[model samples]
Target: MLKFSILKCLPVLAVCALLAACVGPQKQTAGYDYTAFKSAKPRSILVLPPLNETVDVNATNGMLSQMTMPLAESGYYVLPVAEVAETFRQNGISLPVEMQATSPKKLREIFGADAVLYTKVTQYGSVYRVVDSSTVVTATAKLVSLGTGDVLWQGGASANGKELGNVDFGSGSIIGMMVQAAVKQVAHSLADKSQEVAGLTSQRLLSAGQPNGLLYGPHSPKYGSD
Candidate 1:
């Protein structure tokens, strides 16, 4: 009788375990949502150096430069980096290579950037506990319309990787090493987000202008309008 009773309880326990797995913490998508800004053709965009809220020197600029290249190569309307730099000089706003934060929307108005990209590393950490080992970071981006103060589309993403102890770690688990890895992970996620912004920015320009969507894309006169 006891054997039969044990068999009956085993199935119940198995069912509960399967349900828990289904509801486990979700993996990061690190993708953008394109519903906000109207979908239109790709337009000119200013590449602002991201703000490194973390205590890493030149990390923000590095990440911004790395992230911007892929978008520019995609045939997207990446504002010329040199021209943007010139615009800053023209406007008396010096680049804070040491520690600087550029306003995407404001720059849009100054240099005619139809859309502005604002990226920042919000958080990062690393730990190898008895239970788990991991590193993570969070970044938020907002694409604002140059004309109105309205935000066209906004999104954020995060990433993490299995952490290795100081000994087993290839670079050793030094604080600097960990932070670099975390920041890199965050930068990768932000790149994914930039692509989404590029696609949506193109789309929104179409949406807001040609109610029927744009054929000439960014060239549409209705782009960057009220």
Candidate 2:
């Protein structure tokens, strides 16, 4: 009887093992093609003034200021942002829309950059709910070959501030928590915390060492090896 019971469970065990095998981890593919990137071997990058799709007018400059460090650290020479902006202004392309409308060939001709980084800010600043506020900044960036106007790579990232969701308030009462939230709001308003968040977002988008991130440029030590 014992032997028969053990034999009866063998088919069920085999089926479970087969099902597990079928559900195993799937392989992932690198989404973007790097052939052009490798061939171009771009050494200098021009970062454009961000197109601000958010209600916050400051988002454009805030996000723009954060892009240079990450890209430069990624082993590419970045043009002085002030000089670039001023040049655009002198050329009567003051608005981001106007600047973007200018042809990539023209930009390369003027700045002599091998590639350009275009960024868009989709979200910036805080959203107030009935209970609390959540501050978030979201942005997308793309690297385009100035020579060919082909987008070699692109990515996006977001950063969020604390949210007061089902809060215990600890030793403080509801009123105290409200006051604290209000103080935080005031601090953020004065300090423009969105800029800090934008820095984080830029780093995530431009950092070269990450998986699926930009390949090392010719200036980088890992250039061809990457």
Q: Highest lDDT, which number?
A: 2
For model 1, the run of ten residues with the poorest summed lDDT: 206-215
Q: Model 2: how far is 64 from its true place, Å?
A: 0.8
In model 1, the number of clashes is 8
lDDT of 1 by residue, 30-63 (tens): 3333444555233666666666676544445445
Off by over 4 Å in 2: 1-31, 162-183
Checking candidate 1 for backbone clashes, the offending pairs are: 38-203, 38-204, 39-203, 39-204, 40-202, 40-203, 40-204, 40-206
Clashing pairs in 2: none
Question: In angstroms, what RMSD does candidate 2 have relative to the true structure?
Answer: 6.0
lDDT per residue, candidate 2, 40-157, as tens digits? Answer: 7889999989999989999999889899898888899999999999999898889987888788999999999999988899998875543355567899888899999998888888
Model 1 misplacement above 4 A: 1-36, 39-42, 73-75, 95-106, 124-137, 160-226
| lDDT (C-alpha) at residue 41 in model 2 | 82
Model 1: lDDT of residue 197 = 32
- Every model's Cα RMSD, please? 13.6, 6.0
**lDDT (Cα, 0-100) at 184 in candidate 2:** 59
